[model samples]
Structure formats: C-alpha cells, structure tokens
Target: MTAIEIRNLSKSFGAVRAVDDVSFTVEAGTVTGYLGPNGAGKTTTLRSLLGLVTPDSGEALVNGRRYASLDHPLNEVGAVLEATSFHPGRTARDHLRIMTTAAGLPASRPDEALDQVGLADAARKRVGGFSLGMRQRLALAGALLGQPKIFILDEPANGLDPAGIQWLRGFLRHLAHDTGAAVLVSSHVLAEVEQTVDNVVIIAKGRLVRQGTLAELTGNGGGAVRVKTKDDFAPALRAAGAEVEEVEPGLLRVKGLDAEEIGRLALDQRVLLTEVTHERSDLQSVFLELTAEGERA
Candidate 1:
C-alpha cells in the first residue's frame, strides 16, 4: 500500500505556481527521494502534504487519509522540515519532551529518541549551544520520537557533514528495512540520494521531470562500463554504434557496448587500445542528462 499519496497535487501563491500537476506515491518499506532545485516547489509541495499550506487544488493523503483527519499526527506522520524550530534555551531533551508531549506521545520517548540519534551525551546541553549538526540530529530525534509509520524530511542532510550525511543515509535505510516505515527525503543532492534512495521523483520548475526506480531512471544500471583508449578512434567508435561521450579530457564514457566489443572494434580499425570498461553513467551525469534534456526540450 502507498504510505503517502499525492493526487494531481498543485499549489499556487498569487500568480506564481509553486507546484503544478505533480503526483507521486511513497510505498511502505522504501525510501522515495523528492528532488528538485531550490524554488522547484519541493518544500511547498511537502508543506501542503503536511497541512502546513493548503493546496490551491488537488489532494495529499498520508497513510490513506488526509493529515487533518489523523488523530495523532506525530504517530502517523513524522516530519523534520525545519531543523532549528526549537527554543534556543531549552535543552535537547526538554525540547523533544515538549514536542512529543504536544503530540500525546510519551515524553520519555524523547530521551530514547535522542539516544538513537547519538545525542544522548548532549541531551542536557542547551539547544542554542548545539552546532548545526547537533541541531539537525535533534530535529531528527524529534521527528522519530513517536515512532511514526512514515517520515517526511525536507533537506535532512542540511548542515550535516559527510559523516553525518552517511549516518543519516544508513539510518533512513534501517528505518525502512527494520521498522517498515516509508520515508520521503527531499534534497537537491542527487549524488547523495543516488547512494541511499530506492525510488526518485524529480521536479524541475514546478513540474515532474522523472519519477522511477534509480535503475530505471539511469537506463538499466547493469553495473558500469569504463573505456580507456589512447587511439584517436572517436569517429570509428561512433560508426560502430557505441554510445560514447567525453567524460574528461581523454576519457570517453560508453554505454550499451561492452569492453570486449570496443577492443575488437579498435583492433579492427588498427587503433591502439589502452583500456576498456563498461562503467556507464554516474548518478550525477544521469541526473544532469535527465534534467538538462528536459530543459532543452
């Protein structure tokens, strides 16, 4: 079943259309990435889903019902939309207790949640004294306090270091695998999402550009093809029906053609070959191609 369903969701502010005809579903036991550049309406769309902003038209349903109809919102739909939305003087533990208490969850869960996010050592520290990463972890702990069935995190990696990003990725993956919670993580970092997400919904200029499994969006992802040759056989490689493009100065990325075929073709053309590989598109290139191609058309 879909954990979250957005049906023809659209939102507008005056003459500006923030979200336009966008629709996608997040499934149980999976991480679905919500991707778009800044001002691409990702945050606006997410806010509408959580009832923070009423959409101009269309519907957003969490766990098969509107968010407003839910009895305990925190238990049903947990969110970390803003990392710093806490009282500066409050300790992390106090901040979380207040939040979970408002949602009717046991205030005790706050300490456990903070521990889960690796903040147990700093629980007594005032929130204002926390670093950006600490505050982000606190925000995540707040979102996890009720153990909700689904999570909606807008830029969860914001202010996080590389280690923190990696930690969050693994944490989200475990949440889906261990607890069977659906996760909707929004980010502009395609490379990071490519490492963690199972499905992706890409938006550009308030419109859907691509939505599918990472493999499907990246063209069957059968490992990757890497080709290296010192031979000036670009024309010959092209004529042989190998999908090739310049990666750096001398490297050409080839898809759909294997190393063996490339070597044989170069050999037949009397071209010296240094290397051959099948490593195809990286997530960044795949994302760039998808987004750029959409804009070009």
Candidate 2:
C-alpha cells in the first residue's frame, strides 16, 4: 500500500522556497529514509505531509487523503517531528497516560506502549531525571499509544548511544517488515540510514534528487564492479565502454558494467583475475555528490 505520497509538493516562507515540486512515496511494509543536507527542504516536505505546514502548491497525502481529512488520524498515523517536550515533574507513565486520555485510548495503553519502547522499568521515573535517549523513547511511547500504521519521525536517533541506535534499527525494521507499517525517518546519519532503511528519498535545494532502494541509488544494481587483475586493464576496460577508475595501485573501480561482464572481458584479454567484486556505492559519497550544489546554494 502507498502509505504516504507527496506529489509535486512545494512550500515556501516569505522569501525562501523550502520545498520545490518534490514528489515521493512511502509504501507499507518498508522503512523509507528521507534524507538531505541542512536547509535542503526535508523538514518542510515532512511538515507538509503531516499538515503542519501549508504548501504553496501540490498535495501531501497519507493513505490517499490529507491528514486533516482522515476520519481517525491518530489511528492511522503517529509522528515525532521534533524534540518532545515533557513536564519535568511528571513520571514517564503519567505522561503517556495523559496522552491516552486526550486521545480517548485505553488506560492500559500507556503501560503497553512503555513496554514496547523498553521503558517499563523506568515508567515511574520523573522526566527531569531521564536522559536524552530515555526521553526520546518516552516520546516514541506516546506515539505508540495510538498503535498507528504509519510513523513519521525526524532524527529519531539524535541522542541514542551506539547500543540504543542498533536497537532502534531492529525495532524499526520489525515495525515495517514484520508488523506491516510504513516508517518514514528523516535523519542526517547516513551510515545508520544505509544500514536500516529499505528505500530512500533524497532532496536537495528544495527538489527531489533521487528516490530508490539502496542498491538502486548506490548504483550497486549491476552498475559498478571492483576488479583486481595482474594485467593493466584500465585502457582495455575504457575502450570496452566502461568507466574505469584506478582506486589503488592494483584495484580498479569499473562502472557501466557488472562483475560477470568484467570477468569475461578479463578472460578475453588474457588477464589473470585475482578479484572481481561488485562494489556497492557509498551512501555518504552519493549524498555529498548529489547535494553539493545545494550546499553551495
């Protein structure tokens, strides 16, 4: 199912365009990473989808309907757009209980949500004493109170330690792949995003630059190959219409061809192959290349 869709979405402040003709979709049963450098209109696009910002043009739809038009928004969508605020004096469980009351959810939901986010042991602790990571979990617990099918979280790993980050990666995958939810996460952590998400949508200078699976975006889908051979194959590979880059003394990064094709070429050229590996494009490198223009803008 197409859980979230932004079609030609554009938004702007008084003098600056925040999003420009951006379009993308998040399907159910997958995690989609929403990524961009700073001031690249990522937040604006997300805000538009959540109905938090009024766009200049285009539509942001959740389940084919605007957020405001949903019959039961809370039952369909859960969001953590920014840093969550808490009353320092209130305990974690109490905070969620208040949300449940406001949302007309069951009283037991608070405990259930707390447990789901691994906060049951700290349920009675005051918010004032909670660490940043713990507070992040508390915010997530509140979002879970509704048991929604779609989640929209911005920088969800901001305060997590290495272990917490790893746990979150697994948790999100479980939500999307196992529980059949659509998870859209906006974050600057390319490494984690590369490891966690099933698909990616990248924007720059208020425009959509790329959207695809990691393999697709990284050109690892039969697009690049790394080969090591005794013979100097750079000239021959280039003549064969491959873009060859000698990354090191004996290592060649070949594009416009796959490993199988490269191996065949080596055989034809009588080059003894020591290695023929398909190279996955690095997310960090791709991100930098795509957004370099936006960074200067």
Candidate 3:
C-alpha cells in the first residue's frame, strides 16, 4: 500500500542544500501531513517526487517507480505545488483542459474535476477573478482531472477560511476513504494540519525529525501538563519531584510528570481536584523542538 517513497533523496541549489538525504514512505488510503517551517525543503522534496526537480543523489519514487518511469505520470500521482500555477485568464474548465489533455484524459473530464472541488458553479469565471482559496481549489481540481490515485498537495489550506478548511479536510478524507487515494498534505499550520492528518512527516533544515502516526508522535511527546488544584497543591507537587511552574492563575506546568501520575499524587496529598487534562504536544511545539534539536546537533 506504499504509494510514494523517497530514499536518501537529496537536492541542492549550487552550494546550498535544499533537501538533504530525505526519506519516507506514504501509504494509500491515508492523509499524511508533510510539516515544516519555511525553507525546510518540504516543497523541494515534493517537487523531487514529481520529477520537477531532480535529486542530486538517491531516488524519489512513486508507486514502485520513479515519476518519470510511470506509464502515465498524471494518473499515478497528481500534484498541486503552489499558488499561481494556473492560467490567470482562462476559465477553470479551460485551465483543467490543458492539464487533462497533457495527462491524456478526456478534455470533457475537466467538468468532473471542477465539480469535485465545488467550482462547478464558477466554471465559466476567469481564473483571474477567483480568490486565493478558489484558485487553490481550482489547482486541486486540475490535479484531480485524471482521477489520480495519489495526491501531493502543498500548503493546500492556505488562504482558506474555517469553512474552506473543513471542506478540504472532508474532501481529502473522502478521497482516501472512498477512492483509496493516498494524500500528502503539506502545511505549517499547526492546529489545522494537526487535526486533519492521520500521520505526519516532520522535517527541519532538509532533515527529517520524525514520521509516524499522530498517536505515536504526540501521545507521549513532552509538553506542558495541565493540572487543577487548590493553591496549596503547588508546594505539594514540587515535593513530589515535579518542577511545577505556574502557567496561569489556576493552571500549572508540571515537568517530569505524566497526567496519571500527577492525578494520583494530587489525590494522595488530599488536594481538591476539579479538573485534569494533559496538554497534548501540538505541531507547533513539535516543530520547534525538532528544529532546535537539529540546530543543536
């Protein structure tokens, strides 16, 4: 079920290494968030997978073959790399027309794609008139024109409102669940991508920090621990070998303590406990931690 694979893949711009020895696998029927900050070589890596940028060393493969080796590349892997990849003056249908024709899909299939992205109502409108969110949808429609089985989408939710993001999440989930397509949704939006993705591929300075299921990555990730207690609990928590830092008037950040242990200790101390919820490590904290780790190394 592995749909895309990058093995020791690397790319550089003269002396600057944009992507360095990156490797990961994306499986079908899953939505993986390829996450990193700016200039993390995320875009370069995706480009390499699509054969838009040749890796300086190693290989980038799609469905057991390099993108260039695929019998019909568009049908195997569809990509929307960035904004403004569309023709400004052409209608959405016309824009997809060129792409479908290149993919050897029926020119008439553009309508199907347009409809899939909910752009059917605006099919006749010039691309120049579309908002940034609309243009993103159109680009995705273009990528899907051939009914591709894999999607490589970069910053797909940028410029989208809450509703648009919801629509995209549901659409992507549907693509994986219904058609069994594998989706790689790249983004730096922590909370949003954190909610949408099933697994994660995190990179920093062209090096991967972690790649795994959401539970595996965040379940035990160290971050602030939420605690509720009377004011006296602070001193008691410190006595329990946990470094308790007041996060707010009522909440505390207890280091070296998991939520269950903290709760048990609080109960042992006969402290009144009204609420206890562990603050799960979010994408932002994970990114900062990984990036800093890379820097220190």
lDDT of 2 at 1: 54
RMSD of 1: 3.9
Candidate 3 residue pairs in clash (backbone atoms < 3 Å) = none
Distance from true location, Cα of 59 in model 1, Å: 1.1
lDDT of 1 by residue, 1-297 (tens): 689999998999999888999999999999999987788889998999999999888899998888988888888888998787888999999998888778888768988998999999999999989988999999999888888989999999999999999999999999988899999999988876778899999887778888999878775444446666666777887888767787765688876577788778877999876776655566677666666665564
Error of 1 at 225 (Å): 6.7
Poorest 10 consecutive residues of model 2 by lDDT?
Answer: 215-224
For candidate 1, what is the lDDT?
0.85
lDDT of 1 at 50: 95
lDDT by residue for model 3 (133-159), tens: 999999888788778899999999888
Greater lDDT among 1 and 2 belongs to: 2
Off-target runs (Cα >4 Å) in candidate 3 are: 229-240, 246-252, 263-276, 295-297
Model 1 spans > 4 angstroms off: 220-279, 294-297
The true-structure Cα RMSD of candidate 3 reads 2.7
For model 2, residues 107-156, the per-residue Cα lDDT tens digits are 99999999999999999999999998998898888878899999998888
